[model samples]
Structure formats: structure tokens, C-alpha cells
Target: MKAFGSIALAAAVTLGLGGVVLAKPLSRIISETGLSPEDFEVLSATSDSMLASGTPRAGKEREWINESTGSKGTIRVLEVRDNCASLQHFIRPAGVSQTRQIRTRRCRDANGNWILTP
Candidate 1:
């Protein structure tokens, strides 16, 4: 009886562990940063706005906050190429403890819209 009980317990544990191993991967909640595709879009848009006229370059940095989510971060234009720009972005999601720093480059497409490259 003890041997049967032990076998049943072992099988239960093995099945539970197997299920865990096959579970779906964790979400990319932060979504952007670390050179992800999402990061490219977010940083490119912000850089384009910064390059627009009337957006002061006094401190070479801009702060943005999402009033709805309370998530905030900073964007800085590191360099501007003839047709492209490099940027540094720091993003912190609401309720997240760690902020992410990402660097990427954006260039003007034929239609004058900014796009990410490489």
C-alpha cells in the first residue's frame, strides 16, 4: 500500500512539472526596449517629434508621461545624420520597478516619414 501511494504521488508531481514546462512563455509586457521591434517604433516617433521645430533643445532631453498609466520616461537625441537620427530612450512602465534604456536609429523614408533601419 505504501509503495502504491508513493508511486501515485510521484506521478502527480511529474505531471504537474510537465505541465509547467509546457506552459506558455512569459509576456513581453514591457513590450519595448532591448532593441525589440516595439522599441524601434516608440523611439523613432519620439525622436521625430523632438526634431520638429519649436520643441526646445535647451537640455537635449525631453520627458514624457502617460497621465492615464502614470508611466514616464525620458528621450534624448544623441546624433542626427544627414537623413537619420540616433536616440537614447529610458522607459519605465507603471508598477514596474526597473527602467529600461534603449538606443536606436531612425531615418527619413522617401515619403518623409521616419523609419527604423537595422
Candidate 2:
């Protein structure tokens, strides 16, 4: 009985942590960042090696360049909290050897819409 109780407690703790990890609010990140849903359309939903490594391995770089500025960066959806969603865009100029992370804050517009601030 004691062993069963321990197992149940462990399962409950694991489930609780999993729920928190999965329950991120992404909408608030978008609204506060001022990134329209349309902008996300151009972003890669998943992290790709080309973007992370800064080398075009297989994907067409031209398409990304044509869609947006020729900026190389990572676009990720970050959930700041339960009520906020944010898209984190990290950009580095082409041909640059070093990488840097840029932060953009989200704010509401006059109509209470979220906007991303540089």
C-alpha cells in the first residue's frame, strides 16, 4: 500500500508539471508584440536547422528572403503567461559571424490590440 501511494504521488507531480509546460498562452505574445497573425504566416512554426545554424542546408533561402527582409533569425512563439502570447523574433544581418538575441516588447494599440515594439 505504501509503494502504491508513492507511485500515485509521483504520477500526480509529473502530471502537474506537464500541464504547466503545455499550458502556455501564445495569443498574448502575439497581441502584445504587435505581430499580426499574418506576420506569423511567414514565420517557421518549428525551429529549423538552417535558421539555427545560419546555413541554408536544404530549404530555399530565396523564398524566405522574398517573403520578408533578407534578415536571418529565429521566429518562435513564446507564451509569457496564461493570458499573453508573444512571438520572439531574433534577427542577425547576413554575412555576420556573431549572433545576437533581440527582444521586442508587446503593447496594446488604441483599440486594445497588441503590437510589437522594437
Candidate 3:
């Protein structure tokens, strides 16, 4: 029956739209942490400057803050050997009471640029 087919199509359309509404954004899925893109930019810049300005050593640290979003964090060098360094990131997103810590590594390339590495 034409009416039955129409209803089925309408239901499918409604369910599809509902699924889209419930879908999480790609950025949110990528970063389970509450850090926004702006937050990551600020943190990256701080880490680069600290690691590139001079020879990095364990315990060297820097702090970054995004006043607009009220997100703040710290990047600390945990270890350094040769041209590579391991760092720890402490992030506190806005409106959050608990801080999240992440570990990462960077190595200076032949061009003397600090590059994030897995």
C-alpha cells in the first residue's frame, strides 16, 4: 500500500536524523579529554618553546593558560637523552576540578626542529 510505504519512509528519515543528533563530533571522539583545539594549540606552543630554546633536561617545566576558556596546564620534561625528550603534560580543562596527565615524546630533527614522535 502507498500509505504504508510512505510511513515507512518517514520513520526511516526520522530515525536517521535522530542518529545524527546522537552522534558525537569527530573532535570530541578524538580527544576524550576535555581539551579544546585552542587549549591544545597553547599547550603545543609552550612545549615547543621550552624544548627548543635550549638543551632540555629532566624537571624542566612550563605552564600555559587560556584565559578565555579558563583552561590551564603544564608541560614538564621527564627525561632527555641524545636528541630526544620525553615529557609529561598536565591539563586542567575549564570547569573541571581534576587534572589529566598525558605523556608524549619529541625529538629534534636534522633541521634542529622539535618534532612530536610516537
Candidate 4:
């Protein structure tokens, strides 16, 4: 009976780890960042809108907040060129003191859609 219980415990552990390993990459990232899906959505929309606006300029900053999750962030345009813009995101997860920052660049495609660029 003890051996059977050990086997069941091992199986449970394996299944739990397997589920974590199989989680979608984006979901894992969001979870790691301590941001809810709603918070991420708000951030994405705000960033895209800032980039899509005609003639983005450096020093422009936009803020986003998800009241449901209490997560907030700021997106600032760092640099702008003819077709590409680089921005910084300062993210503050709810109740967390350490803020996270992410820098990314986006360029306008021929069809006028913003695309993330390396």
C-alpha cells in the first residue's frame, strides 16, 4: 500500500510539471510578469495606438492601467525615425514594488500596420 501511494504521488507530480511545461509561451510570460491578461491587453492596445499615431516623437509617454488587476504601466517613445519607433515599457504589477522595464521597436509595414522589429 505504501508503494502504491508513492507511485500515485509521483504521477501527480509529473502531471503537474507537464501541465506547466505545456502552457502557452505567451501565457507563461504573462504569468511570470505577474500581469493578468487584461493588463497585458491594455498595455498592447496603448502601445499600438501610440505607434500608429502619425509622427510619433521622442519623450512622448502614455500610461495604462487595468483596474480589475490593479496593474499599471507607462509606455514612452524613446526614439523615432521615418518608419521605425523605439519605446520603453515600465510595468508595475499589482502590489509589487519592483517595476519591470521592456524596450522594443516597431516599424510600420507597407500596409500601415505596426510590426515589432528586432
Candidate 4 on 16-102: residue-level lDDT in tens?
334433424454656666776667667777876786668688999999998888999999999989788877778898989988876
Query: In order, what lDDT does every prediction score?
Result: 0.51, 0.36, 0.68, 0.69
TM-score against truth, every candidate: 0.54, 0.32, 0.74, 0.74
**Candidate 1 at residue 113, lDDT?**
56
TM-score of 1: 0.54
- Model 2 superposed RMSD (Cα): 19.0
Sort by lDDT, best first: 4, 3, 1, 2
> Positional deviation of 44 in candidate 4, in angstroms?
0.6
Query: To one decimal, what is the Cα RMSD in angstroms of model 1 from the true structure?
Result: 17.9
TM-score, candidate number 3: 0.74
Write down the TM-score for model 2: 0.32
Global lDDT of model 2: 0.36
Q: Model 2 has how many clashing residue pairs?
A: 14
Clashing pairs in model 1?
none
Cα misplacement distance, residue 18 of candidate 2 (Å): 34
TM-score of 4: 0.74
